[model samples]
Target: MFNKWQAQRWWSENYDRIKELYNVQRLNRNAFALPTPPISEDEASS
Candidate 1:
């Protein structure tokens, strides 16, 4: 259920909305916003 151009266009437009939703915003910020809160328990444990 995926088209190459359509997918590419999505990536080009939304960039990584899917990845962002999954919290995988590493290389792209066009669609994803970086996580600011601590992700590890070490900080909480401190």
Candidate 2:
């Protein structure tokens, strides 16, 4: 698990890329069966 500071830093550094990947994953998941778990349930609604 990440400490609070490390988590914050990682989010700041990777949020945009993470969002892009999450969207791609969501699209692919909808199109077919995907084994990967979701990034977050909150993201799925947006």
Candidate 3:
């Protein structure tokens, strides 16, 4: 369930609020923040 206008309003009010509430300011400050990619087994072993 997603409404385009509602989404816009949420972000328009203040983009920073999203980051502050999620507590990921240190990890990511982008307006469109995404989770870190998963590491493969080989990459993790190295």
C-alpha RMSD values across all candidates: 10.7, 15.8, 9.2
RMSD of 3: 9.2
When summed lDDT is taken over every stretch of 10 residues in candidate 2, the lowest stretch is 24-33
Superior by lDDT: candidate 1 or candidate 2: 2
TM-score, prediction 1: 0.33
Error of 2 at 25 (Å): 12
For model 2 the local lDDT of residue 20 reads 92
Error of 3 at 7 (Å): 1.1
The pairs that clash in candidate 1 are none
lDDT of 3 by residue, 1-46 (tens): 6499988888888788877888765544575687799999999999
Model 2 vs. true fold: TM:
0.46
**Worst 10 contiguous positions by lDDT, candidate 1:** 25-34
What shift in Å separates residue 3 of candidate 2 from its native position after superposition? 0.6
lDDT per residue as tens, model 2, 14-33:
98899898774435546677
Ranking by TM-score: 2, 1, 3
Clashes in each model (backbone N, CA, C under 3 Å)? 0, 0, 0
